[model samples]
Target: MTETTAEIVLFDGFDELDAIGPYEVLENAAQAGADLEVDLVTLDETDLVTASHDLRVEPQGTLGQPDILLVPGGGWTSANEGVRAVVEDGVLPDKVDACYTEGSTVASVCTGAMVLAEADLLEGRPAATHQVAVEDLEAHAANVVDERVVDDGDVLTAGGVTSGLDLALWLVEREFGADVASEVSEEMAYERGEVFG
Candidate 1:
């Protein structure tokens, strides 16, 4: 069977749960005999990056034109910066514009949806993201909603950190079948949440 490629796209100050939860789901699926391939990647020259919480990750490699591009959201508080820094930089939005096409799927978690918005992909499309980012998404002209996961065919988006797990499992169900997704969910002990279309 041909393996489906899923990339957990990372950036500096990325939220740990938003990135890792989905990654673990995909990894567990592959281990359970799913024909899937998953990796962590970034556009940066260096493989190593420091997340918002100071968790460091040396991604598997740089990105390619992946079949599934999952952008994870980070958070921020008075204590430290997270998504605010990326939004301020405005570099990643350009990269996101170049990376996606009609043939592949593009998805986001939390404020990562803002990156897609910055890339002009969310205009007139239904999407969901972290509550903190909903207004920003609407400002980007997206048809935003409050949901655990939102599926707009090739473009999928999820809310906040833990929702990454929901989106990942949903993708497994979408790519393989309900049985495979259920098995993976059971193995991971993740209760599947509502998926909005």
Candidate 2:
């Protein structure tokens, strides 16, 4: 089987759980023998990124068109210098749009959906995001769903912070197999959540 390469996009003021939850799931799936490659990446060349909760992380590499490109949201509601800043700066969204190809799937965690929306990726697409950003997502012309995860073919979106785990698990099941996803979830002692596509 071919390996699936997944990159969790990191940025300053990004939510800790939004990125790490999926990171842990995919990495565990890899350790469980799933053909997966997971990495933390920044949209631009950066040494370190400070998350919403003050956690510091060094990106493994710059963002590229991986099989799965996961974007994490932070400070969207409070307008802190994270997701909102990235959205306003516009560079990250542009890069995200450019990096997406027919061979890749773009995913978002929490308000990271806003970034996808900013890139015009979610327009008329079924998606999900943090409750706080539901109206904002709708404002972007996305068909917002209340489920924990919404998989719309090439674009996957997850609700609030912890739902990223569900998104990643779903990705594992979709790409690898249900058996491998179950193994990873069992290893992590996690119960899979609802998904809507």
Best by lDDT: 2
What C-alpha lDDT values do all the predictions have? 0.84, 0.91
Whole-model alpha-carbon lDDT for candidate 1: 0.84
Q: After superposition, how far is residue 28 of candidate 1 from its true place, in Å?
A: 0.8
Off by over 4 Å in 2: none
Give the residue spans of candidate 1 off by over 4 A: 76-81
Q: Against the true structure, what is each candidate's TM-score?
A: 0.93, 0.96
Alpha-carbon deviation at 114 in model 2, angstroms: 0.2
User: Can you write out model 2's per-residue Cα lDDT over 142-196, one digit (the tens) per residue?
Assistant: 9998989999999999999999999999999999899999999998899989889
The superposed Cα distance between candidate 1 and the true structure at residue 137, in angstroms, equals 1.1
